[model samples]
Target: MKKLRMICLVSTFLLGLPMLHAQKKNTQVELEVQQPATGLDKSLKRKVAIARFSNETLYGKGIFYDRDHDPMAKQALDILSNKLASTGKFILLERSDLDKILDENDNSNSRFKGTGADYIIVGSITEFGRKNIGDANLISRTKTQIAEAAVSLRLIDVSTGQIIYSEEAKGEAELKSKSTLGVGASADFDISLSDKAISAAISKLVENVINNCMDRPWRAYFLTVDDGNLFVTGGKSQGLAIGQEFIVKEKGKVVKNPQTGLNMELPGKEAGRIKITFTGGDNPESEFSIVEFIQGEIDHSKLENYYIEEIKI
Candidate 1:
């Protein structure tokens, strides 16, 4: 009877091996947990910058640690960046080391101009704690170490310099070790667990941030017009398919805002509509699309004053 029970357990374990392997092999693990079926349009991606991340929590401030601005803050920032990048929904700007990137861009033929961002994210590690809990009996002992973290995020519109979205999330990670007569498993301090906790916390906010940032219009700039052929700064890679039609709008008037001391652009007016006739380019930055004016008229000599926009649904 005992042998039969052992064989049954072994069979159960073998049956689950394929599922475990599949889970481990899943490439979409970096995406959000239980992601919804509906998602953003493939061609529409936003320009995002991680402006700042700070540690507001007292945790991880040891004698050797920089308590004024803890490394935990930077760690959280990196984790958040990875989560956002995984979604492939934004053109992430290197804000943490902008100067270095610019210098490198100057030295090389880099296409990145270090230009404006549609949105910027400011985040902070607000709370963190770690502790070990133990349970012991006559024949066995079990210990678990848990790391919990809370993160706050604020999405700022670079165009208006306003806080567009704000949210907070919490996450926890744990490691458990069990011993039967001190002959089983044991563990020491695991620093990587903290990172996992922070990552989990950041994951909770990524989808929301993406949705809020995408609530605005998408635009493609005019590269040039030559010999009656119009070229736009977007191509197939950006989800700009041939036969797609978009409105061309002349840029709005730039006016100084007395309240915020910022220069804001007024609403642009539709100048014409264009349909994508051809798309070429290897990547987003260098991509170009040839389009024909379907309706209305566009000024070829003053290309800077106009931009191509996706038609509103």
Candidate 2:
């Protein structure tokens, strides 16, 4: 019985070898992710240039301002500029630095003259104030006072001198003590008038700006494949770097919709992970990588499922 089984297994293996050899190998190894190129390189990361912010003030419901002027306008600008700089996505240039560049470049174009910036955020305080209202009629017989402030911001593309984004943010301050009753004795600190309060509001606005730009058309993604010392053809220019892991996927087939009778594209399947162990230093085009590990076989028949290729910078 064992001899017959062995002979049958050998015959089966011999027959399968020839059948597998008849399958043609796919030669299109490298995949392109974007179509039409979008005028921007999909493979390169997006860079930002954050310009100085303008300050403006507006009035709203609250106890009337004292003889001293509140510095909310300036406070807002400082807070927002710092917050934007911390995001690391932007190249934040201080007003002084920009002025110096303009001096060196000696250009008269107000847009860039001295600023090598991609984006510029110009903002102004529209209103700052507190108001009190008193009711004199029998129907009301009372008065109320409220404090308020508002700011308007706009982000412009310096290259095109066009506004890319604009938004208005407002904040209000409530007075706990009436000016008539507490004159000088009232709490010396007003939350709405404090730099910290203004900074917090501006921080929220800066965060909003960041979120808005996350899915922008120019956003880029990176993936690294380093198995058996696999190297990439692109580098910093291609926006790749060390310690990056890219998810591998196999392209899927096109299926037809039963009801519509239209062909629909199928989703790709995940293959494995590729980690970069090395990078091409001092040369962006000559960049290469060494593979750290591979999760699955290199030559899977499922390569048809590959899609959504990404690399890291």
Candidate 3:
């Protein structure tokens, strides 16, 4: 009877081994799926512009050949712009017309309008190359190659020209080839590997940038004011919450600096406070917020210049 029991126990253990392995494999897959998203938050949308990326790599220095013809910089810029746009968290402006705007400003055209971008994104490709990471064994010669890409990115607040966030990220892809007993297989340098590495780095960098930028308070302009009711530019799409209080302020005057010869907007004075009461629901794209005056008088004349600053606390 004891021998029979032992045999039964061994059989059960063998049967459960596959089940345990399957559970462990499933747990690993779940962990991979739980990886954080590499996109910006959808709650608040911001207007942004992506500048052409500068190539700062050694290859860009023309040591071996002229770098002007290299497409790395342009590729990086295009990829980043596409990725950011895909997130749907930003209103990307036309970068192609930027030179025209600059030329207009240089020509002393007073009517050169701004791009209205809240922030400008600039970046440079610092490192982009591939290297061999393979070794030769006695029985089998194995070779591995790694493609790497690195970039430095910065987000500048367009209104203040202040760098709100900056980050650098690096990514790599590996290819391995081995020959055992005269049978061999090898992998060559693939362009897709470099692209993938750069894309991975950009994804991580963008995630970091958005996480940092979103910590700031949201701001909007007052579209219309009717007695105690107020209509604001943003709504639920901009992360406006019910019962949120906003500080009302009058628009400031634009003054030209005598030293730098640049136009600047003076800080506005706090008028009073208002709280969001209702928000548009059907069309989120055209969403607006309705706020009731909590402790301020509506100035009909200032309606055009009035704006709301979110209370962070």
Model-by-model lDDT, in order?
A: 0.78, 0.50, 0.72
Overall local distance difference test of candidate 2:
0.50
What overall lDDT, based on C-alpha atoms, would model 1 receive against the true structure? 0.78
| Each model's backbone clash number | 2, 31, 0
Between candidates 1 and 3, the one scoring higher on lDDT is 1
Residue range 31-74, candidate 1, lDDT tens digits: 54444223224457777778778888777566787743567887
Candidate 2 regions exceeding 4 Å error are 1-50, 57-72, 86-91, 95-114, 131-147, 175-186, 189-197, 200-204, 217-240, 243-313
TM-score: the better of candidates 1 and 2: 1
- Name the lDDT value of residue 132 in candidate 1: 98
Better of 2 and 3 by TM-score: 3
Cα lDDT tens digits, model 3, 1-313, are 9999999999999999999999999999998776532222236667677755778887535556644455777778888988888876766666666534533535232323355566677788898888887677678888887779998998866554556798899988777889887689977766677777788788889887776566764567776766756777666655666676778888688777788666667888888887777878554435688878888765766686677776654
Residue 141, candidate 1: Cα error in Å is 3.7
> What tens digits encode model 2's per-residue C-alpha lDDT throughout 1-313?
9999999999999999866765422222222232112122333433444443444443332477531243554566666777776765554544546424423543322535334344566666665665655534433234344555566777654533446678877766544433342232234345444454455445557766765444443311123343434443334544545555565555456666689554445665766665545556464323444444357544533332242235333
Instruction: Tell me the TM-score of model 3.
Output: 0.61
Per-residue error for 205 in candidate 3, Å, reads 2.5
| TM-score computed on alpha carbons, candidate 2 | 0.41
The TM-score-based order of candidates, best leading, equals 1, 3, 2
